[model samples]
Target: MYSLLFYLALRDAWNLGAIDPTSGTATLLEVTRVLGDMYSKGFRPRRSLMFCSWGAEEYGLVGSIEYVQEYVKVLGARVVSYLNLDVAVSGNYTIRSTASPLLVDAIIEASKMVPSAYDSPEQTVYDKWKKVRWNNVTNEPIIGNGLGSGSDYLGFDQLAGSSNFDASYTFNPADHGNLGSYPLYHTSYEVFSMVKKFVDPEFQAHRALGQFTGVLALILCETPVLPFNVNRYTSALRQTIDSFKTNDSTMFDLLRSATNDFGIAAEEFVARSKSMDVKNPYVIRAYNDQLLQLERAFLNPLGQGGAYSDMK
Candidate 1:
């Protein structure tokens, strides 16, 4: 359905003389106008859609970030996840999806359902064969890197706290004969003929992308529990502190000594708390209370005055 919609959109733009063969400005404007139409008529109460045709994305993630800051509170929670598809038109049948660790298991399960394009002549049966190396089982798909300040998903993942996935495939990197391939990327030569011939010859990759995104969206809509790992948060925070110390020598020396003393005390406290075990209920409560208090130390004041300072 989405593919048909996309094709129709392209067709309508072409038929209406909206194609600007020069600077790609007309293409952007056409897309923006179509999105605006969709937003006005297609969106419903309790369900909203923001169609963003970002400008200067190649320069940096400026447009998306500005949109995020402007409408974060309004759109944040409703946006369960973000699936970015910048150059989905091209690439191999190979699937690459990257998301937070909380969503990693879900993504792995989804990947297992996607049939691979690789083949082996010796094996008569065409099945999803596991790639092994040095006695180690390797059945994992080529997952891309996590969200950074690059594509459209960056602002949502970083600031708005949305789980974001960027997926693509590089089928035949050596096939330069096809004008529809990488040559059109960020260049003046990108056209319908080249895209139709090389980028997506059969649109199989496009179909696979639609399938992947459909599954992910269904999972998000149906799943009752939102997977969140506190341990991951704790580890990330620890690494951030370590990185800050490593980057600044003067602060490193000062913080290193203080952290050493604090670490010893914290370790001792944790040990004693664990030792309490099945002792008096009051003791257990006290230990749990102390641990909770430790978490509170990281919190900053919510509003007004010097009240926004962290207790720590």
Candidate 2:
């Protein structure tokens, strides 16, 4: 199963403007609109797709976290991926995403299929992502690998152990003195008119985000081999392990050896997937189940730092 989560709550401060469209309302509209369009076009998914509108997100992720806690086992066994859209269109400078390592390839593929919000006809979201934001070491479009404690995706990522992601069409931070978020964030000025007048007047950014996210969901639902790149996990692990500046050589060697063994296993898994008999439903289910549960294996059910919810 694939799930799409959009929050329906806003900050607590009272303001003159009753409209709090940018943070949550716009995201909900884009997600529902895409789902409606998909239905109208008569596109039926091979796998299950869920549309979830979470409440009280601004009140410490109350809605989504509780839901995951209630159904962790069921979700862990069944859910393949979770896509969260909290602020879909804050700005249109470029598309930004933070995702699990397993989903990097799918996100890139979906971005390539969607056109840029304000670029030339031939330019795609992938092109903008590469040109505007990328990794210096690899010279490729950059994506956040860690799903930090912030949106609705946290529960799905850490607790349920479902591969998950959050994305937005964002403004360039340099243009706003490198502020954490847009200037009107959580303010009275975050109304529909604000989005129309300044952020995305033509709503092209919103449309682009909708199409990108929808295409990603479709890829997950329709693909037979489960478009996951397990090899990405190897790279992520190595990079993370390298970040530690510990002087304990013994511990470091143990960690490196473990990562190497995991890399070998990942390669073998990919090779097996390629040679699998796709005609057999049992075989397909077995292969796909491994891919789905790979992330769950990293979870510690007892939780991290005495907090059960921080299992991942």
Candidate 3:
């Protein structure tokens, strides 16, 4: 049940159903087209792939949040990944993505395979994104923007703690004042004409975005080990415990000890994943059952419904 929760539906404020251009016609439509192409090519997926186009995303994440609440049991049990796409290429900035640590490596790998539409076909998406953000001294690619509670991903990640990824190409670091953007955010003025004239005149980024997302989806679908690196998360947890120490040393000791246990468990899982017989469906099922529960390990006890659910 690793879902494709496309929040590109539900454009803002048009009373009856009409064309609302500010939403993700640019991104989601391209993905839909690509899926059709895949189907035509006789491509098949090993595991379940669910596609959901959510509605009423403007006032709140009404559609997606409710869907998760309704199917919490089945989704929580079966969902291993949730790839979300919304407002993917509305501005001039390069690729901006946020990933759970597990999918971070997969996203970087997928970007390298997708040819950049802005540059020549030889240059990859990762090449363009890394060139500006790359640190020459450290020799590491710069990190991407973080995901917040603003989009449909919040519903899945907060409610079920689903491992998730999301992104949008929008304003530069200096353009947070909202200038030099697509300028068609949530208003009736967000017509296609404005998008055509001002923002993404060539629509090249949107095309590249489709390929990038498609490649990532293929990797998740076809990979033997699910592309998850539990060690990445273990490292993250240890770093977090290092910062902002609690007043209670006992609680600190407990947290540190839990991270150690988690590290051991992750190593065992990764070893099992690597050594498992990929030809055996039962073996794959056994491996996935373990991997699917990784998301639940992050859930905090939010108890009853008060206001917001816990996102860990």
How far residue 40's Cα lies from its native spot in candidate 3, in Å, is: 3.6
- Residues 200-290 of candidate 2: C-alpha lDDT, one tens digit per residue: 8888888787778878888888897788899999999998898888777677888899999999999999988888999998898888889
What local lDDT does model 3 show for residue 221?
Answer: 74
What are the clashing pairs of model 1? 92-171
Give the candidate order by descending TM-score: 2, 3, 1
Q: Decide which is better by TM-score, 1 or 3.
A: 3
Runs off by more than 4 Å, candidate 1: 1-56, 75-78, 116-139, 172-181, 227-312
Q: What's each prediction's TM-score?
A: 0.52, 0.89, 0.82
Clashing pairs in 2: none
User: Model 2, residue 198: displacement in angstroms?
Assistant: 1.7
Over 4 Å off, model 3 = 1-10, 13-23, 135-140, 143-146, 175-184, 242-253, 301-312
lDDT of 1 by residue, 1-312 (tens): 010001111111112121111112332344445545655896322222233345545556566767766765543434555656555444543554555543555565555555443333232111222341111222443343356665666666655555556655444444556344354454545665665575556555455555554455445434333332223333333444676634546766665666566566666765664566554656654553343234224323331125322211
Full ranking by lDDT? 2, 3, 1
State each model's CA lDDT, in order. 0.45, 0.78, 0.68
Q: Residues 67-125, candidate 3, lDDT per residue (tens digit)?
A: 88887766666676777766666665577777777777788899899876657779887
